[model samples]
Target: MKIPNNLRLIVNMRFYLTLCSALFLVNCSSKTDHIEMVYGQTGTSLFQLKNKQLAYTVKKEGQMVLDTSLLGVTIDGKNLGSNSKISFLNQDKVTLKYALNGIKKMADYKGNIHSYEITEADGFKWKLEFQLSNDGVAYRYKVPGSGSRTVLGEATTFKLPESTRVWYFERDSDWKLKSHAGEWLSADISEMPTVSKMGPVQGLTLTCELPMGGYALLAEAALYNYSGMRLKAIGNNSFKANFTEGDQGFVVDGTITTPWRCILLADDLNALANNTMVASLNPAPNSELFADTSWIKPGKSVWHWWSGKYVDFREEQDMVDDALALDFEYNMVDDGWEAWEDKWKKIAELCSYAQDKGVGIFVWKHSKEINFPENDYTIMGHFLDSVKQAGAVGVKVDFMNGQDKYIIDFDEALLRKAAERKLMVNFHGCQQSSGEYRTYPNEVTREGIRGLEVNHMQEGPLTASHNAALPFTRYVTGHGDYTPLGFTEPGETSWAHQLGTLIAFYSPFNCIAENTQFLLNNEAIAPALNFIKSVPTVWDETYVLPQSKIGELAAIARKKDDDWYLGILSSGSSKEMTIDLNFLKDGEYSAEILADDIEAQPINLEGLNKEANLRQWNTAIPFKKLTEMVSVEGKVTIQLAANGGAAIRFIRSKVEVK
Candidate 1:
């Protein structure tokens, strides 16, 4: 069937017109209105440098809202909104600055009365940009000329701002309650937080405001190139940075330029104390199209093996087979995988086995030591080539501590090379991903938080609480591999809590965080695993739902095909709670709910495929009138115990799909 040339021309014209319209909207939007307050009591602000004028102002709004500025529109007669303020925690302070030394505007942001030309450059292009007001101060620097490499990733920050008195419960915590920083940064910078891409996406992050007016930053970076997104330290080849009182921000004045680079700057400790925002920044592809926004869509659930901390080369084959039977996609065989001379070949075999079982393999290797003695991509490329030859899907690269020009260059180079090899990556033990995922899709997940890995504990802190609070905070920005699943593991406090984590945490490749054999102990947890498999990583709507002291609860509803997966997670005590099914489609459903069950046969992992039928339910729901109800719907009333939760799979057959 041949079509007319005129009709074809019209279609082509429409397509180009649509593409041009989208590009213009993305590149020409106002910067001042990017960060606006929709609703809230916190005093926030928006600022930008354009049209030869520096406009800065304050604002306040509720959660999940952006701050807007009519001033730019009023002053120049242009209705433009800039992402000047993404989001932030509740704290009172003044003076903030962020300086980026390598930023070259790609296009001009033409405002009402002003316009600034854009410049595009590769490598470390030196530049400085900062902002200071009553709200806070932020300083940033970007280094150019460095290779387009991303070495560091998943930075877990620990900061102590200089303004804390005795413990006050009203405050998020006497020592904790600081998850909103990631949101604040997202709202302010229009960016997402990132994690390291190492060992199945589990890393650490902590930032604190000290008692006397100082702040400390702690983090980790990855060595792999998932989709070519990463961070690296440029100076000292070290992973730690400190800021003293009276300092503008993190000092990179004398930092060396290795394959990694990093810089810190702040106006005061108080402002530093109130700043924290982390999430995936760049847009990721949904189907490996070099540029698909769906790929960048934030994922909150993952399954992996590192969380168990199990290291045994002899048992690698058995472990790999077990991981496949459990319905996991990405597996991380850390540490010991690289201990032998032909270890790469062994890993290749394991990857081949995993692929046959419908699972992707991500073998682990240290960033600093990989290809060591030789210290270059040539050797690294050979190793990656072997992994690819063995049918491996991805690699978990670890441990880059700082962000230097060289580090950034190396990171970018590695991503490019990894992309060429058709291998995805997971970065670990490094800095935040500002938005590199937008450019790379194979780079699936990273770790940049103090995750649920039963590791060393610090003084006076509820690490578990911090872990629970990250979803609404840092996760909003990007995909986070919090590494939440565990059964008979060292870090989990309760079985149900571990189950709830599947709902609380977000990641493209959510790690299982448990030993393969350990899953056999709790047959009840099979429902949780099934829930993890049934639920989609992307989301439609998310709400804190409710906040409490004992533990917080969160509700998330995700859509895939014609079904909706609604998950409810609780951290504190078990109790009866109500939920409205109004978000669901209008009609009846056959729901298979996997929740806290006191009495259920132990789950046989090998027979997991057969258990799917055990949890299904037949129920009727009317979402049309659901909004008018004062209480939760009848079927929504679920009973949860301390550290217990539920995952409901709503399959509506009342309406047929085309």
Candidate 2:
């Protein structure tokens, strides 16, 4: 039920007074003010807000187990609940309501907001706010001040039950290069703090399976102006916040509000797959700046970087022509575009050509140049203006490399400035998304994943298992610029599996990372290419199929308008599965199936020595067919090859007027 603002304030005041009285009555006891707020529609989750710490738990069959176990942040070399005298000042409760624009899955979000004000022994005031919803719970800390304060570190801890199993990756300094492609290890929570080859840090997202048959995902939201937080297991099933290295921890000025620490709760893996709580914790988009987002289109782009080609003006023009031929939206002019003497003029000409063909252009720029310290604001403005004059639609800024306060601020400033110039932005070599795209609609996509681009590096190739794991991990946080749908160097996975990624991965500015000529010549997968060309980058709704497994298979169904797209991927081995279409609407729908051909000869990757030539492989294995009958109760069975997959598009049939 919605309450009026005035009535909400009055009720909050009364609740505060009642809590104060209760604290006074129990002042002599060790247990401080024992305040509890029940969340979730079915009373499945409970939050206990104490004077100094917050604890969360999930209930199963009338019995609740500690899902979060314990959570609180230490500040300025002092832990909140340890050796510190803390007193509650006041508390307030309200409802947070908002709608999403130009994104995925759900249209709106509503949650309960609970906030508390407290003072520590040293007179430092802390405001802790918690947002509780049916799907998840999140909390953040705010320290209001006039000048900068030195933060020694944080005590954000996640303690789970003894029998919990964790799925996580070890972190390293070269995280940008290794992104989400790290091999996930399953182990007991007590065996954590698993040291990586580089050091002793854990990845951003940690998925834990509770003893009570539920799951919880530990991650952060709205990460800005602070060093990124990672988990470090301190033994005894406890993980604490370990900030990115800095000389004096994290320095914060003005009113410092830390990022939202989130624990997403789910009954099953499918619920975890469809969770949108991370996006709910972020701020809404600034509509005043980008009121009309009609021109900000999200579609496939042709990239030359992945093909190992030095794209001169002629090569760039060829890519533009290929984009037009393939019905793609943009042609990317990568790294070396700025080296020519008349680079700007040449780029302007190419952009004009692409514009004439109804295709957009995206230009790449070094992050250091754009984030340059000397007169950066003016320099960036002038550069963006020049790009706008050249008729380019977006910019790909690369290699910022750190998540410190300086880099974080620069990222936000860059997005704001890019929005001002009416240009979409794609960030490369950046940190994982914290829903910044929701606030800046023009911020199309960010490469926080170990995408196919890393194929050229010395690191191990991204496997089908890694591809299967992304949708539940990195992609769940926000849009991942995985640069999907690559044909070159198909690495263990079949060509059909590569096609499936075009539908599986979610990127606003999706990159078709293959040579244009090769993609056009592959007649066997022509229909799949057409589907990829027409599929919407953003979706209205999504469903995770029951067949989904962490490193084995990932099958997803997404809806855009009246049409639905289903993508299925398999890892390590071949398997046959029947997919039920009951999630469809009542209307009859025609389906197009694209699957791996059993008759096709497999390319021997061992012979090619990991440096496979694209021209030599018999890459055409996907077989496409359209079904004659239409029914909402239809079931399609598919037999996938090892490291292969399938993509299907369903269109609802319409009745003709008599």
Provide the TM-score for each candidate, comma-separated. 0.55, 0.88
User: Model-by-model lDDT, in order?
Assistant: 0.40, 0.73
Model 2, runs deviating above 4 Å: 1-29, 41-106, 170-173, 176-185, 373-376, 603-628
Quick one: best TM-score, which candidate? 2
Residues 1-658 of candidate 1: C-alpha lDDT, one tens digit per residue: 8989999999999999878744543343344333222212333333344541223332222211111211211001211222222222222222222211011102111101112222222221232222222222222222333333332222211112213111111112211121111211111111112211111111123232223333222222221222122212112211222211112222122321211111111234322222222111122223444432332222222233433334555566666666666655556677676676687677777777766766667677777654332445777788778877877767777765444343445566666667777777777654445434545655566665445442223221123444444544444334555566544332323444455566555555666556555464445444455565555554333333433221255555554555666555565665787766665665666666655553433323232222112121111110000112121233466666555556666776654589
The reply for model 1, stretches above 4 Å from the true place, is 1-55, 60-314, 370-376, 404-406, 455-464, 490-493, 520-522, 526-529, 539-551, 596-635, 654-658
Candidate 2 has its poorest 10 consecutive residues by lDDT at 41-50
Against the true structure, candidate 2 reaches a TM-score of: 0.88
The C-alpha RMSD of each candidate to the native structure, in angstroms, is 16.1, 5.7
